[model samples]
Target: MDLLSIKDPRFLKDMNIEQLEKLSEEVRQFLIEKLSVTGGHIGPNLGVVELTIALHKVFTSPRDKIIWDVGHQSYVHKILTGRACEFDTLRQYKGLCGFPKRNESEHDVWETGHSSTSLSAAMGMAISRDLKNEKSYVLPVIGDGALTGGMALEALNHIGHEKKDMIVILNDNEMSIAPNVGALHNVLGQLRTAGKYNWVKDELEYLLKKIPAVGGKLASTAERVKDSLKYLFVSGMFFEELGFTYLGPVDGHNYEDLLENLHYAKKTSGPVLLHVITKKGKGYHPAESDKTGTWHGTGPYKIETGDFVKPKQAPPAWSSLVSETVRKLAREDDRIVAITPAMPVGSKLEGFASEFPDRMFDVGIAEQHATTVAAGIATQNMKPFLAIYSTFLQRAYDQVVHDICRQNLNVFIGIDRAGLVGADGETHQGVFDIAFLRHLPNLVLMMPKDENEGQHMVNTAVNYDDGPIALRFPRGNGYGVKMDEKLIQIPIGTWEVLKEGTDAVILTFGTTIPMCMEAAELLEKQGVSVRVVNARFIKPMDVEMLKSIFAEGLPILTVEEACLQGGFGSGVLEHAEEMGVYGHPIRRMGIPDRFIEHGNVDQLLEEIDLTSKAISEKITAMVPKKKQQRA
Candidate 1:
């Protein structure tokens, strides 16, 4: 019953129900064994085994396009589509990606990483199918947690209104990294109860219809009554109201039920939504019991006990440091409040939530709502810290521009993971915050050089009464710098000169600052004196110091853990140009135009030529050959 050994594409088609069920168990076991070593999404994948099997059994993939929303739940899909052998390299550099990558396989219809994108992508695919007169089924497996995203809702409205022929499978595990919230979860709960009643009603109507013409009207009446009861008792008419044929609160784990529903949906769809109820970690005991969202996605762990293999080095994470600092700050100021869009654990706001329960808010998966809500709170003279990942914040771009920035609200935007987020890859990188946030008027943006500086930046954001201030930090631990207890406010728009040199100046912030310092040290050994400056603030340029550096006419090398174009270096170039210092050659260093793939942070940096060795070599060569000093 080893499913991994079944290599034939036609193997699933020939399998009987009992064999398929065995295959589901085998797939779960395979995932557990592989993931324990590689460290991938454990719980979400375990839940979708049967659902994925039923999907492949019912519809032909490639011909029938399947778009997986958020893509974390696509591990089962990957395994079923013959990528099981490649899964050992999950989330590693130059290996299999954690999310669905279009280049990896034809079975993966769309390249998706962030939530709520499936519906929109599926809608487009469905429309294309219709236009081309193609008979392919467009199935988008979107989770209940993802449905909370505004874009998903927007697509739902459009698809329903347009009457697009597509199937939206609502994989309701009732979680998205964190436990789901808001009215949507409640609606799914009510639908689940109503689906239970459907079985009894269906049997009763069948018995009533057996009596011919006299009982025909009675059965019809009963059916109408049952429909009325559905509206009154069950809450899933939300999808029905939106013009979708609401099918079930079907058992997602039940292979036959999944196959049946999927077959039905494939045949009769003019926008059908199958509300599939599933446990996140269905078969796996450890993942099923996980409440902290720890097992959602992770590094290699022991399969038996579900514990991570001890990471060789134990440095305090940047997230924990930020969380602790917020908890400490909030104890003194009641005006201080914490807000995250369903990422209390990811943002490390668990400590803040424990300490200030009333003040902390997890605003579901609606980043837009979280931002506007922060703006509303800030309007009332409260300092609200809106903590969210950089890529996910793209969802709330309009809200940040309209609600907060337009009004110049005093909301503290704690843009976490603000650079190349390693293994999660291109879709999840925190590289665009500087490009997006810096352009907006009345916004102050800064990134910390180390953990200690991060604490100071957080304090500065809270204390500043002027306008909205953002403190962006990277994904992992800081460089083991001693954290300060007292909340010290570093001056905004100031750059700290780490190493002064005559050859060139390397300005950087966040995780890249450490790498820049290393480059400076190496260059110094080669007798190339390089100046290293931590340009903390992106919005407000360090005009005085920049002018002094420009006046020196040294080759200015700007380094950041952000996108090279329209980032910190671009900001510096803009300032230099405005000050008529454009004649000086400026070399900008950071992530390139291409989407960075899954890898360790160091390897990723090296791949992009952002490493200390690369930087030192590039700068050493860039420094002019100065007449050889007449030896």
Candidate 2:
């Protein structure tokens, strides 16, 4: 149980099933205790204890690559590979990443936070190994939910066609954050439950092989017979048809079965698919029963009762406001539908799903599918609101351009977490949405200044039947601003001046607006009058407002909780030039062109000079220097 003494030579090679099981329990207990304080992906780690052990025993890591799909389930893998002591720092700044990071450990071959990437990465690794004549195995552990993604399917098709020597362990626990959906899940379920047929078929083959003279010759034909029997009995010929030698439905928790199947998979020459079923929360009681995704990614909790150590006074989440507004709108109109790509709970669409079961859809980590499907629904005269995290939406950029924007479909994209989503870090930051979404034609992109504006935008997007519209909102709580009972649809492509000043104009949108407002008040007290404008719509820039500011010959400052490059500021710069306004000094304030690290959101903002005090001081310094130059 003392994992630090894993310097013991026999840790992997000599451990029996009993010893391994005990170690698994120890690992689970350790994870629970540590995660209870730190708060991380406790459910996923608790599920894969035996499987990680089996994998290490069967294949030499750092040589034989193992790509963990999504990588949240790699906590057990991390523990076994000499990171047990650092588990307490999970998800903290400069600490262990919640997901598998290649930089953190040699055992982690590919870094991943997004889903359905493991197979493709594994295939590339396998082909490269073959090319280099390096005789090492390439194994990718993917889940049933990830399999639902189109990219995973595309990889499967390619891997099947190539018939490369690789092992894909399909971890089927009937869930990925939520209960697994679609026909593929049902097909896998049928295969996993075909034990009766397997038993009978194995007995018959044993009997056939026992006869003396014909036994040797018949053994050759027996494989074909076995394949046929599998097709007749089990429905998992779906994997075999993809050129993989299917091997499981084996108990992922059982050490002997897992090790045996893994050994078998390692020895196979062509593509192999081992189906291992595991519970999402194998050891923890409350997590085991969690059908919702509460335990998927969580904060610190009480280990004994599995109760989250919720903040004493929690803030009203923006996602909840989006969901509540959308639900109310849908209740009023049958044509309004809600869609998400495997993030119903994260986006707070569970309430909508409950009220309008058929209308609410979870496309299962298939961002591309969700986007196109929403486009398709829009074509049929239905308003499909896609509520997806900004980072995940990056996976469907092509679809947004080709399927929706090209056709000018009226789809409402509720872009949640469209800013610096701290703690989750680079792979999960929502800062690139404005840059990417702005370039697409026939697409309207905007961010709300507060929950009231978010709700208003939702209403505006619902009524407008022109082109694809997107409304982005940041993570966590609203600004606690009271909502308007009646939806006030502001004119599209107009900016509202919150505070009128003469020195310089600060144009901002989304989360940065409040910060700008704070800066404005500070500047007013300092005798440097500043103009504050909430440029709600990123696209279709308010020309009148820009013209007014140019007429005053005031310095312009643009701020957003998005990327600095080609974002709202770029739009302002481009417009200023187009309007023939010369030598207007402009300062663009936002996330720099670099990957942000994990930390608390407020700390990260301060680090990036996005805090109110930082912005106020910067503006004060800039204006005074400009006035001196004029003098």
Candidate 3:
């Protein structure tokens, strides 16, 4: 069975059980080989092999609408939908997307990258199907971890109340990046203990009803006894109360179990929750043994030895620097506490959690809850450091504004991955955080030039008692600059000049600082002096420095690795307008309005024209003809 020849999922219906099992093995081998080089959500995809196959076999996709929640597990779904040949260029620039794309195939009815969106999307699709009187099943596959997300719960409540004709596949692998948290995980744990829900529970209930015999004497008490059995067998009366007919804690890897339950779900009325248990990284040795979430999403790895092909002796990651600094500070201050939205491994908070287990908290999948929880902690005069990814912070915009900023609490937000996060693409790029948070009142947003400065900024943010402060750091390792033995607090709204010049100025911070330095060097060769300024504080920008620079009447070029509209550069322009320097020669360089796609950082930067060469070119064009004409 050549998997590359697989055009669509239609052929699955004709295949026998043995053939289907063989096909599943082939698909698994295909993914293991393909992802060793391309590197994707292998753990997630590996976990859903039989489940995904059974889905295609049980439901008609294009018309029926099998929507994936997070879309990371859709790699197997992709292979069955005529995308096996595109594996070579997966997640590359202009290549096959890592997530489900509606334009890619007719089978991909709903596109998603973020978690906990499928239930809502499926609910809408199910309603639309009913309105048109179409006889097609709507299935949404979601993880037990994602089930903890507020949006998923909201959709669950809505779907149950509406009684939509849909099937919800609760893919319980006991993990979402890190092993799940919250009370919901405990409920799923109990549900897992309660075996096959459909048959035993139904049979026992039928027997209990038959105990009444010919007359209706003991009927009411028998009905109450039958109802009480729900808590004992299914343990998922949780879903039943919400109006969904709860099914089995079925074996997701077993073909017979999956097919049998899936077939039964189609005949059922209202929303049905099919709890399917799976083993993440079922076949792979290294990934299967993983508990720290190392295998969730990875770089290229050696298939034979399972060794990651990462750069050797690289600088410490920005996440480590920031988290370690906070951990160090937490030692002295009793009020300091840490929180993350189920990204303890990603944010390198293991050290903090180990040292002070009670102080550190990992709130699973609920960014909105995490943000407000930090605010609530801050109100008690406790320092809550909420470490979250920039892209994910979009989900908690209201909490950040209404709860944190509006109330003027002292919350330290560690905004990780604050720029274009290469491989994960537009759905993950952190370009919009500056735009979103810059406008919020009583919020101080800042970035750093190097790891040394990053630590100091983290210290400053923790110590600062005026309103909420956020420190933004890029995804990968730092510049490997010599770390300062003593950390100091940088004054609020202060900018540092890295290189001085008279003709023009280039203002940038964080990852773009090195680019600005190189751009200054490039301009120096052409006899154009360009001053490089680390405009670290984005919100309350260094006003005194701006005044002096404006007084000198130098041409200005604001560079950032973020969106141009309402970003750091926009703040500079607005300041210039207020300072009566609107007519001065001003230029802005940053990411344009369009969303950037997957690729390496260098390629994505070059594609967006955010390179040193682009900066040099922009600065050269800004100033008058002052070319040295190298002799």
Candidate 4:
């Protein structure tokens, strides 16, 4: 079958089992080929080929809804929903989104980028359907990893009690980003080997009903006694206790099993948990064998060898540098412990975990719980290093303010991917941490200018016991600067001048530091002597430096690779206002008040005018003709 010719999944209903099996293979090859050129969530999408096809075949979409959790694995759904033509432009600027977009297609009724949200959204939709007297299935396909989230569990409890007519598809692939970790994962493990509990129930009830007189009542009594059988054979009864009718450990890839289970779920009343077993990265050999999550998401790779494409030479990754430094420090300090919310691979904490196994804790997919756990550990006078992505950290905002900041506990937060993360788009961008975290009392926020300073800042954060301090680092590799043999702690609330000047000063940090330097050099050739200051500490502004620059009567320009409102630039502006240093011109340049989409970092930066040329132009306008003559 020509997969591109598939405009919608309506044709799937007409195909037999053999044709469906063949179509699945074609879809896999299509994904394996297209995703090689335009990188994406290939492993996830590859795993769900048959399952997605079977779903569209069983249910009527755009009316009978299917809400995907995280929506990363919706690539197969996209192909079946008349989106094959947009494959070339996947994850590019103004192109196909990596996650579900409501406007993209009518089939995409719900949009999701974060996990554990589908169940709650499903509940909302189910309730709306009930109130309107509508007849449609509300199926939320959530993974086992997502099921461990607090929100998912909360939704499960409510869903069971309400006894709403909804089918919850539990896609148990045994992984979420990294290998799933928790007690919940262990329970699912039991269900995988618990051969067809529903079949046992049906056979036992049939045999009992065949007995002549009083057999019907006897069979009904045996049905109640089946709870003991559930406890023995499988833990899926765990779902039964929560008010759901547990279905099966069906083979997700098998057309017969998936179709049968899905058909059963549609007819059942109340909430049903149809547990379907799938293999992540099911088709391609290299992705299938990837145990370390290397193939979960990827750049372009050679099809034959499966080797990822790369630059000739690259600097050390920021994640590796930070994690390795933590490993080195943990060698001496017993109180120093590392924690991540199930990002051991992405945060490069495997080395740290290997070195100090006892001190490492990975609280899976629970950012809120992880933050409070760090605060609890801090109460015992232990130094807890919480390594979390900036975008995910938003989920723990309340914990940050209420628990960590309020008590002034010594929690060290390594805000990884602290700037504009490319390709993942607005849902996963790390551009809002400073805006949200800066307002909280008793919190110190700082970003490093380069790799060398980044290491020092990490050292500074670990040793600082005054209160909660955070070190922000950008995504991707460092600047490849030479490192110091000894790790030294930088003084708190201090700023350094990179280039001396008589005209305007450019205040910036982290990813934008190099760009500001280039802008300064460009202005120098054009006779404007610009000063570049690496204002690393965001919360505690460099008061002395601000006073000196204000006294010098130099115009100020603040630049950041973050949101413009309530960000690092906002901190600078607030300081100027409080100090009554108002005569000089102050201009702020950063990401505008909107969400940035998927693309390369350079193109996204260029689109927002956060480049050297834009900075040069802004600074040039600030400095006058007479100031140039004086310099």
Each candidate structure's count of clashing pairs: 0, 0, 0, 0
lDDT by residue for model 3 (378-469), tens: 99999999999999999999999999999999999999999999888879999999999999999999999999999999999999999999
Clash-forming residue pairs, model 3: none
Which residue runs does candidate 1 get wrong by more than 4 Å? 1-9, 197-226, 627-631
Write the residue-wise lDDT of candidate 1 on 449-496 in tens digits. Answer: 888888888889999999898888888777787767677898888988
Candidate with more favorable, higher lDDT: 2 or 4: 4
Q: After superposition, how far is residue 545 of candidate 3 from its true place, in Å?
A: 0.7
**lDDT tens digits, residues 1-631, model 2?**
7875553223677778888888888988888888899888878888888898888877888788889999889888887788877876777777888888879877878988999999999999988998999999899999999999998999999999999999999998888888778889899989888764535676878876675656666677776776688778786579878888788679989887888778867777899999988988888888888989788878889987888897666657999998889899888899999999988999999899999999999988899999999999999999999999999999999999999999999999999988988778888999999899898999988888888888898898888799999989988888678889998776788889889988888999888888899999887777788889999989988988789888888888888888899999999999988999778778889998898888788888878888888788778766856553442
Tell me the deviation in Å of residue 346 in model 1. 0.7
The numbered model that scores best in lDDT is 3
Which residue runs of candidate 4 sit more than 4 Å off their true CA positions? 212-221, 628-631
lDDT of 4 at 43: 85
Q: Clashing residue pairs in candidate 4, if any?
A: none
Candidate structures ordered by lDDT, highest first:
3, 4, 2, 1
Q: What is candidate 4's lDDT per residue for 46-66, written digit by digit as tens?
A: 889999999999998989899
Clashing pairs in 2: none
